[model samples]
Every structure is written in C-alpha cells, then in structure tokens.
Target: ISVWTTLAALLGGMLAADVVLGVTPAYFFAALPRAVAISNLWLALGKSMVFGLSIALIGCHYGLRVKPNTESLGQGTTASVVTAITVVLLVDAVFAVVFKNVGL
Candidate 1:
C-alpha cells in the first residue's frame, strides 16, 4: 500500500514538475529514467518497506505504553504520532547518508 501510494504521488509530482517548469511531458518522462536511475527507485522502495515497518512499530510501542487515564491516552497518542514522524525523518536522513554512494 505504501509503495503504491508513493508511486501515485511520484507520478503526480512528476506531472506537476513538468507543468511548473513548462517542460513537455514527453521530455520529462524521457529524462526521468536518467534522472532517477532504476537502482534509485529500487533503493527507495526497499527503504519504504523498512521505514513503514519501523514507523508502525514505533507507534505501537508508544501506544502500548499508555496509561489508563484519558490524559495519558491522549498524550500517548500524540507522542506516538510525533515520534513516528521523527523516526521516519531520521530514517530518511540515514538512508540519504548511507545510500549516497549507492546513487540513491
């Protein structure tokens, strides 16, 4: 699901980029392959899997740690969301750094 969502977003973004830059769709599509190599796509997909799982786990962990009180529950839920976002960004940074040499 995440991969599909990412793909859909990528397509939309590509189209938007073309319109914003006043480039022809044909040319944009033609250059896309070279701009984003196949290896980069695969690497992004692979990292998406890792990122999705890790984010889910982080959310679940934080959620399960909640206390019985309503306030605690709210706090836990907020924390889970914030933490998940942080984790995802951190993981993304890590991927950028680690995969830099790999052409991601």
Candidate 2:
C-alpha cells in the first residue's frame, strides 16, 4: 500500500508538473526513464518498506507490552510512537550515508 501510494503521488506530481509546463504526455513519458534511474527507484521502495516494517514491529511489540489498565495502554502507545519516529530517522540517516554516492 505504501509503495503504491508513493508511486501514485510521484507520477501524479510529475504529470501535474508536465501539464503546468505545457509538456505533453508523450514527452513526459519519454523523459521519465532517463530522469530517474532504476536503482534510485528501488532505493526509494526499499526505504519505504523498511520504514513500514520497523513501525509495524515497534507497534506490535509495544502493543503486546500493554497491560489491561488504561495507563499502561496510554504509555505503550506513546512509547511506540516515539520509538517509531526515532527508528525511522536513524534508518533514514543510515540510508543517506550508505547511499551517498548511489546516484552520483
């Protein structure tokens, strides 16, 4: 779902930009392959997948740690949210460093 949504947003934005710039669909399609390489596309998809997986795992882990009390539930939820954000940022930083010259 995340991959599909990202692709949709990417293509939609590209199409909108082309239309606004008075570029035809044919020209847009022709330029797209050269505009973004396959490796870059795969990198984006892989990052999204990792982010999604980390978030899901964190949520599930904290969720199971929750007790029957409301307090535990609230604390578990807060911890999960905070941890997920932190993990995503760290993962993104790692990716940036690792792929610094990927498209260069």
Candidate 3:
C-alpha cells in the first residue's frame, strides 16, 4: 500500500506540475534535489498520517450518516481520493514554503 501510494503521488504531482506550473517531467526531476533539501521527512510523514486520519474520520462519519448504498460507497471513495491528493499537495506546498522562507 505504501509503495502504491507513493507511486500514485509521484504521478499526480508530475501531472499537476506539468499542467499547472508548465514544468516538464525533466524539469521536475532536475528540481528534485531542491525539494529533497527542503523537505523535513519526519514532519512530512507525520503530516501525511494526520491527513490520512482526517480522511478516514470524514469517510467514517459520512458512511454512518448516509444510507448504505452504491452512491454512498462511491462518494466515500471519491472523498478518499480527494483527501489523498489534497494531502500530497499540502505537504509539498508546506515543504516549498518552508524551504523558501528558511533559504534551504
């Protein structure tokens, strides 16, 4: 699951950067060193877990509140996907902001 999650995040980030930032995959690869230098692995891991928990909690709440139906199940899955993407972006953004601010 961890490997799959990481792969998914890598793909999503690459796509987002390409589409939104006008950065090619090659440029992203070149910029990886800067990303690594700035990111706090431990903090990012903790934040990622927190984000996962929040998503789980939200899904659970919705699951309990809504009727057990195909639509509800689909909604839960969509929520999970959105949560995962949001967490990945949030972590990257935090890393970038901190790196810039601290001159990393």
Q: What are the per-residue Cα lDDT tens digits for candidate 1 across 1-104?
A: 76787688778977898779887768877887777778877887899899889988988898889989999999999998899889899989998888897753
TM-score of 3: 0.40
Query: Model 3 RMSD to the real structure?
Result: 7.9
In model 1, which runs have C-alpha deviations exceeding 4 angstroms? Answer: 13-22
**Residue-by-residue lDDT tens digits, candidate 2, 1-104:** 76788679778967897778877777777887788777887898899999999999999999999999999999999999999999999999999999987755
Query: For candidate 3, lDDT tens digit of each residue in 1-104?
Result: 44466668877998999999999999887886678653444455556676667667766765676657888788877776687678667866876676554424
Candidates in order, TM-scores: namely: 0.72, 0.90, 0.40
Top-TM-score structure, candidate number? 2
Task: Report the number of backbone clashes for model 1.
Answer: 0
Error of 2 at 5 (Å): 2.0
Sorted on lDDT, best first, the list reads: 2, 1, 3
Two-way lDDT contest, 2 vs 3, winner: 2
Ten residues in a row with the worst lDDT in model 2?
A: 22-31
TM-score of candidate 1 relative to the true fold: 0.72
